[model samples]
Target: MRANLCSLTFLLALTLQITYTTSKHLAERPSFLNPCDYNGANFDKCFADNFQLLFSHWHDGVPGLKSLGSLDPLSIKRIKIQQDSGATLNIVAELENMLAYNASKAIVKKATLDKSNFEVDATLELPALYAEGNYKVKGTVLGLNINGAGKCNLEAARIRLNFHLATKLRDEGDLTFSDIVSLKAKILEIGDFHIDVQNLFGGQRDLEATANDLFNQNWRELFGILSPTLEQTLELVLKDRFTKIYAYVPATYFISNMPRASEFYG
Candidate 1:
């Protein structure tokens, strides 16, 4: 059970890593992604709309962003998650052809960029994402011990995310520049979650059916215990992802039309 739990954690981390990893050099922003003008009267609204558009094309590789064209139906080597030394739950699983969906439907509540101090804040609400994959999972889930294999699907619903990005000032010879320094992300709310893993107890058809029922019936309680750790993992994963992206893509591409740092400081 411990082994399986570790494997699930590893696989989940791998899945998230692959989803956001990007590296390429584009001298300018892609035309499809229209940049927002900070000087505009409706800068916040413009920025929010632009942010939503980015997610709409998230899974698909935008030529201007990265060339890693496809990011769906990923083959997971292994996955494991253990809670409290397996006292609560332990799951070690493997998934083939995994795909995560519904990011395009995300809604941006508000987004603001404060150039004076080089800070960015955004609030977003995601209704749900259905993740489906062919899986083999073993351990305790919903207070039942079971061995399961076959198709599995899960849904995480009513999640809200808040993000803040900070920048640092850099002095290079005669020119001063603002560089992305850090990112903080938080999960504000999670209303519900559903997990379905088929074929539990290995070859026992009746037990399998009953286990699935229990999973559906007791998801809320299970999720409540799991949400805290999940949120921390998500925040760390997202911070790493955006930081890497900013590393590869120059700041000029993001705010080229805005007033120059020279003009503001001079």
Candidate 2:
């Protein structure tokens, strides 16, 4: 489950645009404000209940969840850069945009918890995630900076992921969630895109048109190069957060049957 949550966070970095709002259908009083009581008579039920509550809050984006808004289009203040040159030739590029994610659309396919292990699988289909902004660049072809502004939209058909988590009871009667046991995802279909940047590098219409044309032609390559790096970064961030949340969970909540620990499968 840690991997799953982290994957969602990573997706948010690429997309989350608005704060999560409570849903009438899923809304309810929180089952537990903190970790479950490991010593509760029904420790298994208590553990499952707590997991469900957290999952719902994450899916709906309640107040206390770690909200990473840096990549959100609205939160992006500005992106300014001054580059000198490059090999073969000199080039420059400056761009900006706003991004957002729809928590309401995040769908959980499966969630399972046993003893000290947890797992979750889910998918999300973003109708449209876009950035409405401008850009400026120079060097290489135009030999001079050209200024332009436009919009970029990404329509993702589906995003599917699976995550597994392991936990151990501590000497202090608390539980500690191990690092993600496994994290896997398949992001499919970014089928549509639009880019229109006007040429501002003097009256060289052909040069500007050429630059825009080249960019449009190779945007896919650019996305391909960047996606993997972003995914790894997100995985690390989620792992850290998961460990912290589980650190404070009382061990009793997971091992109420400590005497029979040898018989527990997870």
> Which candidate's TM-score is highest?
1
Q: Which candidate number has the best lDDT? A: 1
User: Candidate 1, residues 1-266: lDDT per residue as tens digits?
Assistant: 22223322433443433344333444456665666565767767876776666466554644554423323332233344445435556555566556667756778899887878778798989898788877776677656777767888888899898888896544443333446687777778877777777766766878877887787777665565555556655555456545545554445444436655566666
TM-score of every model?
0.71, 0.43
- Misplaced by over 4 Å in model 1 are 1-24, 32-34, 64-79, 85-97, 134-137, 167-181, 248-250, 256-266
User: Each model's C-alpha lDDT?
Assistant: 0.62, 0.42
* Per-residue lDDT of 241 in model 2: 41
Q: Mind giving the per-residue lDDT tens digits that candidate 2 earns over 148-198?
A: 444433333344444445544334322222224555444444554445456
lDDT at position 42, candidate 1: 75
lDDT for model 1 comes to: 0.62
